[model samples]
Target: MRDIQHIEIPGHTLSVRVDPGPEREGRPALWPSVGEYPIYDPFLYTTMTTDDERNHRFRAALAHLAPDRRILDIGTGQDLLWAREGVQAGARHAVAIEVIEDAFHKAAANLPALESPDRITLLLGESTRLRFAPRADVCVAEIIGSLAGAEGAAAVLADARTRLLEPGGLVIPHRAVTLAAAVRLSDLLPEQPVAFAEAALPYLRSIFGWHGSPFDVRLRVENPPADALLSEGAPIEVLDFNGDLQTQQRTTTHLAITRSGLVDGVLTWLNLWCLPDEEPLDALSMKTNWATIYLPLFDSPVPVETGDVLELTFAAALSDDRVHPDYQLQAVLRTADGQQRRGSLISPHHGGAFRSHSLYRDLFPAG
Candidate 1:
């Protein structure tokens, strides 16, 4: 490929190079235009750095490593902090892999200045496809998404367990769980159900059509009010990095309505367990980059009274694209007077498959 080329955006000009390879296929452009630095945002890195609980647990796990033990850090960002910390913690060798070219270069520049520079080997490639000489004693990767396994962590760690690590090797986060709870949404519309439904008319049309719902989004609410919670959170799915990858899981939980309120939908988050005995890191209330995922049920909130039982059955599966996961919730709410109401909420599931169909070929021809 050629060297860096300059291109202009709305505010400024940028220097960037287009990477021509299969790895870049189907991936969204890193910037607004062609000639812009890929993965240039520093806010995400800053958020991760400020997460003291996450950093402390990882450092504690690194402290358990003995001298001369090999460590593998997958998806190492610009700082290469995990690999550097491993080397400094008495690891004999540290292999850091970063796929993005710009981030890899930044990590390379920072690696040489680390405490044990000679012990770290920087590789510019994806960990899922790359192979190393010998198995590592410890494997660490921070590919976690909002949902615990939504970012293909289970698949990546499963592959690494068999191919990249030695027998009984340690994975930084050995266990993870996606937790969810019923929540009463703060009113977004001035009027009640009518206004909300009117606002969502466009989305409803798109969702039922050949395309999909553009409003399909995850919401992040920081420090929600106490009244927002309708029921206690329950674990939707549990993932073991060292064990089988749960591409699809079916679980059920019961939510008892604390008080009479209008419940909007379920709010979900992740819990990561770095050590066997240590407390799992919470994503809902923690100072981490991950935000609580809000899955709305209806256009407006559903009314419920105190002592209502919400029996929720959730079926979650990783999408075929291996990025976002699909979730289907079947809820049966029983009132105190023995009246039962059934409601179902499903995320965009078959839309991608429909878009790929031959009959719908013209809908997304460019794809």
Candidate 2:
């Protein structure tokens, strides 16, 4: 049986059903599965709010907004933090949009406490599909994903800028660059060993010609060992939120090997430029909600040495869902002795089939 609870918001009382199974740290799990995804995780929200670097950059960007300008906040989340910050920074009016119902209710509940509640309007819907008067002087969105634009920020911001914002309007996090570098896989492997029972069961199952299928999994690493770095981070893609949000991006960079090491895969991170000509928030060394992502190249580490040059071609294309993008990396390693090795890696492994879905074709026929 599920427990029912009512949450009070600005204009209505939200009824929430609580599942009675697992508990997270003695507190009932408040996150509910909604449609294709679960509601925003509270722990993740907490981590984001606690990220000093991210908050500081956002505040700096908001402070640059013109006084009395209209603001539109997309994916406001639960706290409505950025929208509230805009109002505090002199935005005359604000429109906050949230697609998740649970997050919307939380934002609604916090609306009444804002310094100027009457100046803000909360809308529950997808910003890309919602129409608004083209009068907003600024558009603020924090929909950046693990892969920077992986959350469909490109398409969403492109739609908003063209349809909602006035000419010369500002976009907080005006630009972003996705970066990658070759690294030792040993630097990211978990230290703990699998339990005896768990390890034995998996091995036994595999002995009967029932080996598990191979799949791609991205790992989030807080801090990679310094000695594991094989090459300097190279920019793979640059996104201009204020101008064009490219759905497809490709770049090639040559990285000189810094030291001899075993290369397992590449390390990816984001550098978010909150404002033009301002310092960016670096995900690699900063305390932020985002962690460095590890993209493995092989099941085992590939040996490498100093004085080698790695030519990497990185490409990312938005899927039919317009959210998660498929990524591919092609590598050609040439040694000082003229020997060369070539390999390639693709995320999602599922070829271009997802892009042909009928729903995406109907929604974005131009693609």
Best by lDDT: 2
Clashes of 1: 0
Candidate number achieving the greatest TM-score relative to the actual structure: 2
Candidate 1, 77: how far from true, in Å?
Answer: 1.0
- Cα displacement (angstroms), candidate 2, residue 356, comes to 22
Q: What are the per-model C-alpha RMSD values against the true structure?
A: 11.0, 11.5
Q: Per-residue lDDT tens digits of candidate 1, residues 7-51?
A: 333343333333232223222111111001123235556667677
Candidate 2: TM-score? 0.77
Can you tell me which runs of candidate 2 are displaced by over 4 Å? 1-39, 190-215, 349-367
lDDT (0-100) at residue 67 of candidate 1? Answer: 52
Steric clash count of candidate 2: 0
If scored against the real structure, what TM-score would every candidate get?
A: 0.74, 0.77
Residue-level error in angstroms, candidate 2, position 126:
1.4
